[model samples]
Target chain A: MIIDQNKIDETIKIIKANGGHGIQKCVQCGACSAICPGVKAGFPLLCRALIKDLLNGLLEENIENSSSWGCQACNRCTEVCPQGVRPQEVVFAFRRYQANELAFSTSAVTSQMNLYETGHAVFTDPKEARRKVGLPEETPTSAFNEAAQQEIRTLMDNSPMGELGLF
Target chain B: MEQIGLYLGCNIPLKNPDIEQSFRKIFPALDVQPVDLEGAGCCPAWGTAPSFDLNTWCAISSRNITIAEEKNVDIMTGCNSCFGVLSEAKHFLETPATRTAVNNSLAKINREYKGTSDIYHVAHVLHKKIGLTKIRENLKYKLDGLKIAVQTGCHTLWPSDVYKVKEDNPYFPTMLKELCEVTGATVCHYSRLEGCCGMGGMRSTDAEKSLKLFKEKLLSIKEETNADMIVTTCSSCFMQFDMSQPILKGRGVIDFEPIPTFYYTQLLALAMGFDPQQVACISQIDRNPIIAEIQSDTRRIKEGM
Candidate 1:
């Protein structure tokens, strides 16, 4: 596969801007892949391969690969990287790039909607549960407070995720 | 007594209020006051805002932290993912450029990110503020002779630099083990102690793959230790083990008897003599066996005294 230098430069720039400063420092020692849960779970590509692809601008071809979405972000990759590559940050950077430039998965979309609608990603009615536990029907969360929920809506509306139509 | 804002995140209050109750019950006993950070939204969740944009992540998380800052207290959470996103957001906002960008978004809601407060996982507060000796002295029912498998969860230990309180050895954390041991439970160590519970984004992304990862850890715990109960400091991990295990068992993915899971705070609340029905009752897996063990031990201790 031919490497696109422009794509590599663009990806690298975004990564560096997003606190992935150590991404360029990655030595491709495979330490991250060795401990990656995604790799261990039979994902063909992982932190090491992803970093190599990101640097080589080879990620465009493999953009739809489930491995990127499967990352648990466990940070074992970051913890073991000898060069301070912080591969997890790189994974998140790539994911952000994927969501904005490529396409995000359905689950990500649902989560964003959940956050936008209810101020929570996994909200359920807690009145019964709280009553069962002998606590007040409503705790100090956005579940019952309309004003706080409005604040979350405003924050989401003003942010990049909002611009992307994610929320 | 130092007071801290209790950031419940989303999952615990909605999906697992028992975990919330446990924190409420345990905090007062330890001389730590858990003030409610009212009108707090989600930590915005890592898989959601964080995966989309850094500034959005920071803005939403900073809004939650700002609630604690308003009350002049540090924020603490029982959810590891909450700690992960909030602490990492705080770390990003520490940089002047990121802080400026995030605060600009917060300004839309008439809020600002001061970056004044610290974020803590519940275990960190217990280990750092309550102290192991104090925890031991206050136990109403010691967990003597009970074997427990400890799941530290990935978020609590990872990116250790951003975290205010961390495991002494990030890879091989002893704080959760020490806290469990203080209640007289024998902390069982399994090979996959640091493994992910497949709880967060992974489960949302791919359920089968997530369960496979969880099954590997479960089999490891059963193979390596005779742990009577699984104790974790993270609410998501508690749901993964306590809630998901049965579904996996029903699907024939796992063959062993399901091990009940407890948040460490729930165990602490139980050991402090709170009724199991109130603080520990909402689990999918029955806690009767462990509760029986605890009750028998308490009876023996009282009779001997």
Candidate 2:
């Protein structure tokens, strides 16, 4: 990819706008990528690649990439990066950009919708499972309590996430 | 008794309540009380609130953290993702502007992010706050013959800057290994000891590829250690190690018999002589035989003496 200073500056602006404050600090040392599970698992545009792409002005263009969703949010990249780029934050920022455009990897949809409805990204009907182990059918969580679920839904609707009209 | 507001995230109390049961059983045995952080919701998790932006993520996580903050007890979660999301939320939410922003959102629900409470993963609580010497003293059963391959999990180690407790070195973690040793189970070393189990978002994205990644890690655990079972500190790792074994074998991903897996709390609960069914009944791999082996061996030793 040819260096487009225009594109680079634009990418940096958009990412910083979405909270990738350290996007420009990336030196492309590949240290973050070296230990990234998504990178090792064959997600092409994760740590180093995502940072490299964003720095090369590939923000909107890479919006559809599932690699951002592939991140475990383990923050291993942040720990290893010498530049303090916090590659995980950059990945999350790109995810935010994608989330804003509503161009999410299909796998992410259920969890987002679940979070909206249930307050938990990963939820299951707990009654049967909990009872089998002699636990209360209702876990003291938002999933069971109607008021708490409403509280969570209202909170999500009241934030920038609600601005996306995901609900 | 020291009290921790038990923040029950999605996986532990819902999908695998057995781990929650085990944790509850073990904490009291150590003279610590598990306080329920009732009406606690999600950490809002990464794929959900966090995928949008940090402000929204922190706002949502602050709901949970501030619940404990009000109670004046620190938060402890069995799920590493909860620990990761909540800790990172607490750390970043300390900024005045961010704190003010999220506090405004929180004011709707009458909860405030006071930044008074801290977050602890099960591993951190086990190794750092509650020492291993306490662990060894409380054990009624010894895992004399069992060998364990320990999965310390990624979130428990990295971004150590945000964590209240940390491994001396994240790369070569000894805390989980030492926690196992207190049960008298020999902790084995594997090449992929610190690698991801591919259980979290990666698995949610691509199941086959995620299993493939775990297969590589499982192979390392199987061959490098040839251990009796897999032990881990995170519930996600427990789900991956325990539930994936039979599926992997069925899919021809691995050629060996299934290795049972446990969260260290369950192992400690059993070592303290809790009923296996109450503490660890739910599993893909049968845990009954392992339970019998540990219990029977203990009973026989006591009888002999």
Candidate 3:
């Protein structure tokens, strides 16, 4: 709860650097949280609360909070915000910081690995399902195309995420 | 051959290909070819690439969209996450800086996103692109006497600024309801019609909590509207509704028998007289009763003819 000026400035700077350009536009209105499904689902640090903490210099202090992972990326927070803060962007920005810190929620690591392996984070074997549905056993997607997936892997491998070695 | 690139994200083609199969049948029946964008990957789903870096998210999604851009057609998907994430990537990539960075990653793959291809969800394509009148005219069966509840889901509704297809009013959306009604089904209004289904990020993070959130929404659809079935436009919402009920019931979370669910295309394909097993019969929850009801309507129409 201690408001360190240096920490607060660093917090604002990090989030803005991570694509939360509208961080300072927030007027502290609770409209974003009022409509945030993540908060209602009991993951406390999202939208208003997460923004409040980030604005108050609690970024590193709340690194391990899994609430950011609960964001549906529905952009409902962006829709209802009066200040045009786009609170969802702020949440994602903090999530970028968290991911960089290697504080990934257990589920995130699995999905990231899936992306690296199959080019789809939420992949499943579609052979049986596609067959059952009377379609070709393999979908015409990157999941089955090794060359395309290799291209995807190269793209991810060259990105900032590759630098983290999470893949 | 009027066509659009069919962007099948992770779930539809892999987990629930029935929705993919239905889309294939429905769009072509309406005279719009669902062209396959081969080699397209995930929307890079929110939790994966998007969580790591903004440009990484845009780049991975851009790779998928660039496939459509190369085909010189916009993209359409049933997955709301695909719709939302792809649109967000397009919007972000419009900026000079973000576009430069994302295109850098894409350049390594020999693809450059010129931001030409717009992202379209199946809901938008059906209502706005195909037109309700066109849909109604082509239907071979009408779903009379079937009371339905529609879940529009989150991604297709929100942050409207990024989407090219604008709803008349995103908050109280009427497009999905109208699309359903054209097939002669009454889309009953429920209290939580616009509420989140608690899928996507929440589902991956905490399965049980996500189920509870979905249960709350399902209970609203049941207690308030007493709908005969649930229909949604988003693949993720369709999956959550299709997969969650048995879990909710098995855990004794709800005492009512679960309602069968469909992605809009699956139901639309049935209304157009496609075979049930091919288009609508692959849900975790049993949909035989609803499919039978729809098939009987088909028989009556055929007999009257």
Write down the C-alpha DockQ for each prediction.
0.76, 0.80, 0.84
Rank the models by TM-score, top first.
Answer: 3, 2, 1
Candidate 2 Cα misplacement greater than 4 A, ranges: B298-305
lDDT string, candidate 2, A1-167, tens digits: 67889988988998888778898888899999999988898999998888878888877787778888788998889999999988888888898889888888666677878888887888889899888888889998888778888878878888877887667
- Write one digit per residue (lDDT tens) for candidate 3, span B1-305: 68999999888888888888988888888889988998998888888888888998888888898889888999998888889999888888889999988877777888898988888889888998889999988878888889999988888889999999877788899989999999888889888888899888899888877987898899999999899999888888887887788888888889999899988898888888888888876778889987888878443455434
Looking at candidate 3, what is the lDDT of residue B122?
A: 91
lDDT of 1 at B4: 94
Lowest lDDT block of 10, candidate 2 chain A? A104-113
Taking the tens digit of each residue's C-alpha lDDT, what string does model 1 give over B117-137? Answer: 899889989999889988876
The interface RMSD value for candidate 2 stands at 1.2
Candidate 1, residues A1-167, lDDT tens digits: the string is 77778988887887777556788898889999998888887777679998898888765676687677788777888888899998988988878877877476776777788889888988788898889988898878987889988999988887666777665
lDDT of each candidate versus the true structure:
0.85, 0.86, 0.87
How many clashes in each candidate? 0, 0, 0
Name the Cα RMSD for model 3. 1.4
lDDT value, residue B157 of candidate 1:
88
Backbone clashes in model 3, listed as residue pairs: none
